[model samples]
Target: MSLVSINPATGEKIREYEETSQNEVEVILRRAQNDFLSWRKTDFEHRNNLLYKVAADLRSNAQRYAEVMTEEMGKPIKEGRAEAEKSAWACEYYAENGEEFLASESVETDASKSFVTFQPIGTVLAIMPWNFPFWQVFRFAAPALMAGNVGILKHASNVTGCALAIEKIFRDAGYPEGCFSTLVMGSDRVGELIDHPVVKAVTLTGSTAAGKAVAARAGGALKKTVLELGGSDPYVILEDADLDQAVTACVTGRLINTGQSCIAAKRYIVVESVAKPFEEKLLEVLKGKIMGDPTDESNDIGPMARHDLRDELHDQVKRSVDAGARCLMGGEVPKIKGAFYPVTVLADVTPGMAAYEEEIFGPVASIIAVKDEAEALKAANDTPFGLGGAVFTDDVEKGELIATKVIEVGTCFVNDFVRSDPRLPFGGVKESGYGRELSQFGIREFVNIKTVYIR
Candidate 1:
């Protein structure tokens, strides 16, 4: 596919970009490798200063950058602004904590003194998605750059503008030229890039299929990789849960970014005693949601990032309904001009249906009624993808018990929706992908752990 930015809200081509030629990519690899020699030697204070500068620049141009993201990916303007702010937060987070995270540690060895030290491992390749363009890239950039490794970004083809803008952010913040670069290229070129001598490791945040392809190539080359793939996270509501708060959180959790988030609550597994009331309140809250142009401040649900995605999600919902699932609300695509799908709620969903089996990355929630807590836990762990999950209950001990019992996820939140924080490691298990990002654990992923000894 060509590298271009097409506005999903209006189906208009904003701009087209030429993909980087093989020769140009080689030059980038060479430059990044050469620059790292000097960049890795730079003082931690200098690196911290550059990170602070990046945070300031992101905040200064938040509106313009957010608008670019909204235009390129159909994210609501409010969410777009929030994304920009979050990007800045990540920059600041690494700036404050990275040096300490990478500091040498003393260890007891047979010698007089021995310790472990963290060091950069040359250049890294980051393959990112478009859903939260700025935030996703910055999360990787902040920690990796602070750890003294340069980055070459292979962002989603449709978010070329956002990709270029991010490259500029690092350059403007005084990172040496080529310390960070964006490669406007197709998916086919990624394998070649991975095998390049200068590219030492890879980090990817995308679908399961894409993750597997990249991991396979990186594995053959013996390069380390961190993969954050798709998720069919469960949002369980127990009988003792706070119905009022649970309903409110579900609405926001299930529909954030039009339910396109990997951590969004896709499956709603509630105990039968509370299922009826929860479903009723969920529909009532969903009815008030406004779907339209992302630029509009009042619009809650925007168009899918692309037309094909909307069609695919619609097909999944249709198949589920045909296979004995009942639509609780908003089953059909809205009569809108762009790639719009209504916020659908499906009831009586079973494992055999397409909706239950597939990751429906849209504004659709599948409700599965369970007899009790035992069955609820069983239903939640039934998916192949286990990126993130949430549990709601008034009893803290009960919530914690259920949280621990659920299998196949990176993080499980009690009485809240799944979210990423700068202080905690985030990743997934099973087909969802391996490795971690964010927090101290994330910074260590791209570094070389070296042991030093003294006789």
Candidate 2:
């Protein structure tokens, strides 16, 4: 069977790639294992220099990579470029910091000299999603590779072109023959890949169901797994918030990546006293957003990654409207060609509605009005997802309190939209999956923390 890449913006097939057979998979795994043995022995200076070259290559050809991504998965050309640059930043961050992050730590004990050393664990399989195709893989690859582990990527079928392009970046940067490889196949092969003896660990960035399945499979193999799964992140707008600032942050957060991001703000929990004005400002901004060809650069929103995904989001919006939510604007699919869905707004969202319950992975915003801060906090934490969140308020102390102490999420922002940075740890709790990515914490996820006591 072959994996087909489609231009989601035009509903046309871009290319088809033949799937990797079991024999080919074995060869790749064996090569990766061999490379890892030597790669793990490389000193920090050599690894760091190679990664710096990789980062330079990423920035130099970012636009070309962006074009490939835009063609394959319907990401806006601008956002695609930004994604490539961000991926480069991750490469540099890990390159500069990996050695320090993994340095042995001395611990006083009864033994003469006790310390913990981080060591590379061989091959790691990364199962990545289509959205932010380049960034997701680099975030995992840069850290894993810098920590001395080789990577075998099983990216989403639709973004196969992107997966190959990323592989090329590392290959051209003087990395060894088996330092990185992309498997152009469907999800059916993931289990076998995880079960491979050469694969010492697995990391996945995708849906919750997929995470669970991979986690189960990897667990059966006694291999470690780090999952970055689905998120229905909430933005709490307190009564004391600056209406203008709140609307801008909320709209930008929700519409980012056309709302395909797992950490994109999905729900807006606003205190009732300011709900009307906030909604008015948000609608005004949404109305001005242009939805059209992702290649145009003028369009503010592009189509969902696939026709089926767009239809699924529409179904969720329709279900919410039918279940008592009020549609303020843009609920229907556009008549134009492609998988485009217009910027949609739903207000009065409450329990039992699809918008309130499930993640709407499109450019749709759900507004939930609350009686006060207490109710707003309650509504924010009502969901099963604890990925990321944001709080907007003029009262800095209160906003900080809500962001730092009250919200039950892995990361929180005060008066700003939630974003993943190379300097910070990004992940979630509860159903959004466990384990962290980025920062020092991320680089250590795939390593063996060995304890040594010298007498």
lDDT of 1: 0.91
Q: Give one clash count per candidate, in the order shown.
A: 0, 0
Residue range 1-455, candidate 1, lDDT tens digits: 36778899888899989989989899999999999999999888999899999999999899999899889989998898888888899999999999999999999989999999999998999999988899999999999999999999999999999999999988888889879999999898899999999999999999999999999999999999999999999888999999889888888888999889999988989999999999898889988898898999999989999999999999999999999999988888777688888889999998899878889899999998999988988889998998999899999988887778755589898998888988899999998999999999999999999999999
Q: Number of the top candidate by lDDT?
A: 2
The regions of model 1 sitting more than 4 angstroms off are none
User: Local error of candidate 1 at 161, Å?
Assistant: 0.4
- TM-score, prediction 1: 0.99
* Best candidate, TM-score: 2
As for candidate 1, its clashing pairs are none
Query: What's the lDDT for all of these models?
Result: 0.91, 0.92
Per-residue CA lDDT of candidate 2, range 1-455, in tens? Answer: 99999999889999999999889988998999999989999999999899999889888888898899889988889998899899999999988899999999999999999999999999999999999999999999999999999999999999988998888888989999799998888998788888888889999999999989999999998999999989989999998899898889988899888999999989999999999999999999889999989988899988899999999999999999999999999999988899999999999999999999998898999999999999999999998888999999899998888888889999999999999999999999988999999999999999999999988
- Model 2: weakest 10-residue lDDT segment is 188-197
TM-score of each: 0.99, 0.99
Each candidate: RMSD: 1.0, 0.8
